[model samples]
Target: MLFEDKYEIIRKIGSGSTSDVFLVRDRKLKKRWAAKIIGIYSGGGTDCRVKQDAAREIQILTQLDTPGAVKIIDVFEDSRRICILTDYIHGISLLAYIHKYGPVFEQTAAKWLLQLCGTLDYLHNMMPPVIFCDLKPENIMLKDDGKLTLIDFGAAYQQHSDVSPGIWKGTIGYAAPELCHGTAVPDIRADIYGLGVLGYFLISGLEPKQVEKLKDYSGHRIVSRKLDRILSGCLSENPGKRYKNCEHMAVRLRQFLRKADF
Candidate 1:
């Protein structure tokens, strides 16, 4: 569909429970952008609630200005839809990369961890900090330049934003147990749990769901405890057992890397 009488839809690139993403091009600028279209209209007239949710995501995007995030270039709204225009990222999902290239090496994982932690730290430190409740490998994109970007923010919610219940929470194995059950309010620990799951999968080349049975490390023997210690805590069923936040987790990572000298 044509939008704003200028942005032409190239094709549908992706979709989510709440919206569909299309690759669109600006006729004047000859630049491409990903437009996430969220339906805000119903049979009667307008779905105020849906519009509110769309606005929430747009608001969160505007506050984000980090390399780890896809930059928001513009926004468009009509009678029936809200379009969030963001930079078109050309990359592979972390999960897809791991499948094709095997688990990332220790050195690579360490570098990636710092980048992710820095990104999350920025998100968590926002004015009304945003929590990326869903952070599985599928949500992270690895660019050709070796930089990682958090591509999906549909589940990101501002801290104490008075959101209604029944919203999308998180994944099963990757999400913190509390999020799985919708028992505890989302916090930094939830993303930490996801980091643990992703880290374990990358290092072991095994599924996080089988983290118990595959009690083995496929990488180096040195990172066995140093990295696993923190990751294990992140996988804890209880949030208290996980690192307080990204800053706390990054400190451990840096300390371990310095000692391991990898």
Candidate 2:
């Protein structure tokens, strides 16, 4: 189908519960775009809610103009689907890269972490502070130019003034422990915990549980002790014990990079 009077659907690329993404080409502009088609349901039901959520993701992404974030060009809705057109990214997802390359080198991982830290800090320091509920490697992509872009803002939300307890939104392995309790609100600290999990996976080639299973290492013998310590601190089960915010975490990571000559 036609979208925005320019983008013509070539084929489906990817999909999620809320939307289906298609690879499209702009006939007039002669550019490629990933068009996310969200289903629209009437009668104010679950489908309607899904559309709302999809729209919210687009809204949140549009507001974030950071280099580390994906670039969205426009959004459109027909009777069947709500389409979000974004710049086509040409690189493998971080998850695919790790599986293929078998974890990243120390310096490479540090560089990636720093980029993500900067991105998260930018999001957290905003007036409303965008909370990215999904921060796993699967949600991150490595551009062909070796740059990083945080994708899938479906779970992003702005902080509310009420400050009341709320249900958590994040993945299991990478999600903060406080989130599992269902009483915590999404905040910058949650991102810190997720980053820690990401660090462990990227540097040690092991997940948090695997790192735990390495009881033989005594926590101090792991490769890159400095990095391990940072990851362990960031992945703390206690939210209060994690980094105060993305800014603090970035500072620590920056220091480590400089010391390690990354």
**Strongest candidate by TM-score:** 1
Candidate 2 residues 1-262, lDDT tens each? 4575677788987777656788899898788888878788655544665666777678777788888998889888766777888878889888889888886777788789889989999999888888887788878989999999987787777776333454444677887777767678778888888898887788666766676753245454445777777777787777889888877877877898898883
Deviation in Å, model 1, residue 126 alpha carbon: 1.3
Lowest lDDT 10-residue stretch of candidate 1: 214-223
Clashes of each: 0, 0
Error of 1 at 158 (Å): 0.8
Using Cα atoms with residue i matched to residue i, what is each candidate's TM-score against the true structure? 0.89, 0.88
Q: In model 1, which runs have C-alpha deviations exceeding 4 angstroms? A: 1-4, 42-49, 164-167, 217-223
RMSD of 2: 3.0
**Highest lDDT model number:** 1
**Model 2: how far residue 193 lies from native, Å:** 1.0
**Could you give candidate 1's per-residue lDDT for residues 56-157 as a string of tens digits?**
788888888898999888988889888899988898988888899987766578778878999999998988889998888878889988899998787888
Q: Model 2: how far is 26 from its true place, Å?
A: 1.0
